[model samples]
Target: MSWPGGYGRRVLAEVDSTNAEAARLADTLAGPEWICALRQTAARGRRGRPWANPPGNFAATLVFRPEGDARQVALRSFVAALALYDALASLTRAEAALSLKWPNDVLLSGGKVAGILLEYPAGPGGPLAIGVGVNLIAAPGAEAVEPGAVPPVSVLAETGVRLSPEGVLDALAEAYARHEGALVTYGFGPIREAWLARAARVGEVITARTGREERRGTFETVDDDGNLVLKTAEGRVRIAAADVFF
Candidate 1:
């Protein structure tokens, strides 16, 4: 797919994972806003989990070598979520209700529509890579998604959205540049406004996983550090990581 900006996309018929492939090329690739789109991907999703990437579905990775700090990494995910949201919204009025789940996940009327995975290389001078997967033609089995959570949704011929994987990829890159520019120039103050406009909700009960025990609380706000602030029974809390839900 072609984008008007100085952006470019490299197509892959199939790959083990776009994020992994991008990581392999990080040192050699010189392009700043490089994107890799895969027709099929194996073992996708954040935290190295598996996501069903059936043929003809959307699977892609966008690698960015930002002139920003790790503290500003949340902007990457926010821009990604907004891009997907705007694309889907433009394609279908049914998707007008799309919202963003904190950190990174796209929700269509409260059900998951897309998921984003951000990878930051270890050590200094490492850039961030974001992997995004959307159920274009098919949703995953219940066993594959978060348990006891909202059912999944998709955008494809089935949803009457008539969107193609290539179209989504194009939209992602274009939308990303716009939002990322806003973030870099204006800081998170404005990005947070755009995010909150489509955010899941405040005061909604959620559980955050931290690799240890789970913390349950009401969603508060996005703190200055980009961490999610959850208001528990004790007090407001900051969460660096979590599998959130309402």
Candidate 2:
């Protein structure tokens, strides 16, 4: 498969982190570019947790100048999630086993198969980098994840479908372009509907946790501003960001 036209692709044998690489290259880029590394010596996940990127797994970052306010640019997490969902489904041919976890993780058979982390520039008015990691051939052991978090699973481990990181990137880049086009042209309405359809356990109880607090409630809808809405005993709560646990 080929990457969509006008998008740039780069494959590195190794890097400290793809997100770091994106930050370095963002200034030089006139268009969107994808950076994939075969081996990352150091990678970080949400809340600065260490991300385990095995030699054969998929670790990549997409860098582009975004439009709209902070909330709008942040909505691309959903954009990236939906793209990753379709990309994995298409490549593994196991669409039925896949579903999206809120705020940014992809699940397969109830186990985490991939994750997306978005990073904004340190300086003002700069590009955004969306880093994506997938356990293509191998997943870190359960010990690496947080307590009560979904166990990690790989595409190869679950589906017996072998794929290289670049192969996945080809499908992913194309899928992202399609979803991103919808976001840019029609607004978040279509993307929100599509994401909700693939969402996991929307009507069920779930817990959203942050460093300072935790909230448990029935998963409601994601609001127009991309906040996770939950119906709790106290009231309907909208969370802008948190680690969601089912």
Candidate 3:
């Protein structure tokens, strides 16, 4: 698929973080551009978590401006997760093991294989930077991740298929174009349904932790606005942001 607005593509040997560079170029660039780096010295994930930037893995960010209400832009994370799922399924032999974890994670064989992070500029109406990192050739060890974090896996380890960073980026770009189009033309209803179909653990007992407060209940369905729905003994609760665990 073609990139939105025929935006320019830039590839760098190294950078502190592609998202940082994209944020800097957002205004000057005419349209959304794809920024890819061979290595990131200070890469980060959701909530400022340090992301491993091994040379063989994929580290890329797309900088673009949203047309309408910016608050709804947060739903792009689900769109991105769907794109990543499509890209990985095209290469993996264990297709059945692939599933999308809520919020912003892609799982392979029940282990984390890829992650997405969306960042915006200082003020409103600025470009949105979508950062994606895939464990292509090497997965991080227990020591590299946070304490009690889910174990990570790489595409190579899971499917015995080796792919270059550029190769994965090509597939991702194509998949993103298709899913992004679906979000625009059909609206969030279609995207939400597609996401729920591949949901990692639906209709199961789980816990969602947001800061100090923790809520435990049966995982219901995500709402129209993308908030997670949790059915508790007391009543139904909607979580705008939280870390979920099974």
Candidate 4:
């Protein structure tokens, strides 16, 4: 399958974090590149939450130089999530239960089966890394997750079809290529529509927490800039970064 920017690919037996490794290789790599790890000793999710993947799970990162403002580039997380949704929907019999959660998560049967994380350098117009972790064969139990984090699920559990990590990676790479191309050609409008169609909850009540502040509101649609639009009794709020809960 064709990768974004025709970048190189590497699969490793182990790594600290695919995002970190991608950053280290950004300067040397010409364009977009992918790094997949069989296992991660120091995996992490959004907000530095420790992420531990079992042997059969998938951990991969894509490093690329985007051609736009840093804020625009950050929206690639949504694209990545959509790509995963597409891959999972095409591969699983339980497609009806699959949905994309706001910001950066894919839900299967109301449980999180995959997540996307985006990272960039200190300044703008530099190389950015997109990290994706899929619970293909196994998912951590409740004891392994954070106190209030969403419960996890695996594709195998949801579909009764076991998929190898490499198989998932190949499908992900192809799906991402399609969505990334769409984003470049059409813009965020099309991507937004596609995402909203598969969104977990819209027009539902939800809570968003960031730092020490919390806001409860009706979950509205995402704005053009990819901010989560929330309608609270006080007023309309745009959430750029927060942990959303239903």
RMSD of each: 2.1, 0.9, 1.6, 1.6
What lDDT score goes with residue 102 in model 3?
A: 77
Name every residue pair that clashes in candidate 4: none
What are the per-residue Cα lDDT tens digits for candidate 4 across 12-84? 9989989889878888987688799999989889888887688888999988887778677988988998889
Q: Which regions of candidate 1 fall more than 4 Å away from where they truly are?
A: 1-4, 121-124
Model 2 stretches astray by more than 4 angstroms? none
* Candidate number with the higher lDDT (1 or 4): 4
> How does candidate 2 score on lDDT?
0.93
As for model 1, its CA RMSD to the true structure in angstroms is 2.1
Q: TM-score, each model? A: 0.91, 0.98, 0.95, 0.94
Q: Which window of ten consecutive residues has the lowest lDDT sum in model 1? A: 32-41
Q: How many backbone clashes does every candidate have?
A: 0, 0, 0, 0
lDDT of 1 by residue, 1-246 (tens): 347476557877778887877787777666655555656546477777788877767887877587766677756787788887877776666656788898799887677878998886434458677788888787876677767665777775335675677777777777777887888888888888788888887768888876787888988888777689988988988987777767
The best candidate in terms of TM-score: 2
Give the C-alpha miss distance for residue 99 in model 4, angstroms. 0.7
